[model samples]
Target: MSKVGIIGAGLSGLTLALALHQQSIPSIIYESRPDAPLNIGGAVMLSPNALRVLDRLGVYERIRTRGYTFTKVDYRNAVTDTVTEMQEFGGKDKYGYDALRIYRSELIDVLLEMLEAAGVSIKYGRKFAKVLEETERQVTWEFTDGSRETAQLLVGADGIHSTVRKYLYPDLVPKFTGLAGITAAVPTAQLQAPVDLHLPLTYVLPGKGGFVIAPQQVDGSEQLIGKQRRVEKDLTREEWAAFMADKESQVKFLQDIDPAFPEVVHRAVSNIPHDKINVWPFYVVPRLNAWSSEDQHRRVVILGDAAHAIPPSAGQGINQAFEDVYMLSLLLSDTAKENNKDYLAASLKWWQESRQARVDQVLELNKQIDLRRLPQSQDSDGLEKLNFEVGWLYDIDLDQVVGNWLKEFQ
Candidate 1:
């Protein structure tokens, strides 16, 4: 049997494990966090591209049962309260999936449950501290506890501050955007009074770095939405709490942006303490010339945040990782059949070539989103073009991207 090892039990890591399992390929996952569910105070959108991958893993029905499918995407000017662009999501029944909005924890639970059913073992508290690749046949991992394990292939699905990334791209660091996201969920009743706009999975309010508000449905549970301010990353925890402490102040600030803003911001305030709100300093590893070695055949490779960490502005971070898994899984399957063997080296090479470009394109789009949030004076005609051209993002096709991999593999 070919042993595949995955580090990190996050969305990306778990998704990769599930994909491999569907292929009847066995793998093990090592998680640094204690064995417990993480409840981050935010929601995420799973585009049709991502939904297809989940469905193939047999988790889509479970996810849809838990989340709300959203068809329309609307963007508005935060200052003028004018709708800038609205578009219908393009990819659906073609692959039998649609965009969805769900809570972070709910998504985690669904993936974890599927992984468990696959008989994939996730060793929690076993942090990946170091790794060394000797040859195509052998790769070793050193955990924080001084324990070690060897595998035929090692994957670094660990998130942003990935120990694997550091080992590979030792000189590079994810650049901070200077923008911070303060996210929290609020009750629907609290929002209905001040703002009359029917919400979608996503809404953008234009301003200095602006705001985004969207609904998130927990797995088979209740629905909730989040409102967040895009601000500078320099604020301390104390500053963030103090700023949100006064509901009147938050309301007044929203009023300046748009009369309807208060309806959204106030709801966010009521759900969690001004203090419990999470302040995320967005960062990304910009266009990397490449993610593969000189020969393009190595026992190690990165997936998810470790490979292409990007800001959430476009909501592609998680979706992109799912795309990676779908594409790479197909490639590996093809390589196995062609060689009539494991063919780990050829699989890694083909996977890298197939995935790197798509990942780069998504990273660039995230940059465009960041540019759109810059001060009005900094905006240009190009930025205006981007606001109108984001339709592709909402309409990506994962199966198409996977292309030949499906034929050669499946």
Candidate 2:
């Protein structure tokens, strides 16, 4: 059997590698980074839809113990300092799995451990350059290191700025969402707020900016993850530097919103070292006519952010990536009998068709959530509708969805 070549060691690529290993498919991952453990991202929320897939991969138990779990979210008005709404966000009873909050590094560590145990090879510092050639039998990838590798299939799980996506569809590009996300994590004990610390997650929406505060466990330490989103785009290096350097002004902005708001969020923001604060501009991938090469025989596919990147408002970015890996792995497993180019091509087409619609829905849902959280929208009904849509998203069962897709193939 020809080994699968995976690009990027991100959550999607690593999960796909593990899922394929479960089905006895041999594969290797080529990461552009130069090291095994890369700690470059902030906290992430894993909803039940994603947890269910991780559970199937046999790693959720380990992950569950390393993260904080929450079941409700408090939506408050930053200007009035009043709780507008409280919703049951996620729980096993509601969605058959718990919603977890953990640093992105911890999750990556768990994934790397699983891959190592499975004997999956990951070559670091192997930046993907472009497709060198594609034949009926195999597709070859050239890397920046002036090396090349050939495999039966190439899966691009890089990210929003994916070289693989550019190789497959050079014209498709990610569009800026006109929003920026600033995040930081601090010891929960540092917060001097009088509000109940044990309460559910909280979101304070004021003007055109929104703040999300949730408790998280990083390296066994209790920390609170504070995320702020505002309508800002294409910030230059100097502008970003200036923004980070003025911590006092940022704190004042929070304090001015609501006297109580700063107590809960300001401490976390101000206490974290300036270098530790993360500011990322949000971008979304335009809906593609197809997520894979038009010629099925080409055997090149894209998943996760490469396929469809969405805003973080819905917290479905990582969840949708897990779903992509699960579905693609299942379809590839079904092709094990034939184990040829034809079967591989057919499986890739099925995987793309099976996932594209759901991806479209999730992207649109994230957009709607962003709109409701905008400064102009203060209606409780909009918040309620956003909550309902989120619940609907987390309730989807990828296993059942794949089972139905298999029935059609049968």
Best by lDDT: 2
Worst 10 residues of 1 by lDDT: 219-228
Worst 10 residues of 2 by lDDT: 377-386
If scored against the real structure, what TM-score would every candidate get? 0.81, 0.87
Tens digit per residue, CA lDDT, model 2, 1-410: 35789999988899999999997889999999998744655778888888888999998998888888887667776666667766555788878877788778888999998999999999999999999887776788899988999998888999888999887788776887665666655666676656554444455555545676676773424454545545556565598678766766554443443444545656655566544466666788887766777654656888999988887767888888999998888777775446454665556677777677777787666555555456454322344344444666678777787778667665
**lDDT scores in order:** 0.64, 0.73
Q: What is the lDDT of residue 188 in candidate 1?
A: 52
| Model 1, CA-based lDDT | 0.64
Clashes of each: 2, 1
Model 1 TM-score, all chains together: 0.81
RMSD list, candidates in order: 4.5, 3.5
Q: How far is candidate 2 from the true structure (C-alpha RMSD, Å)?
A: 3.5
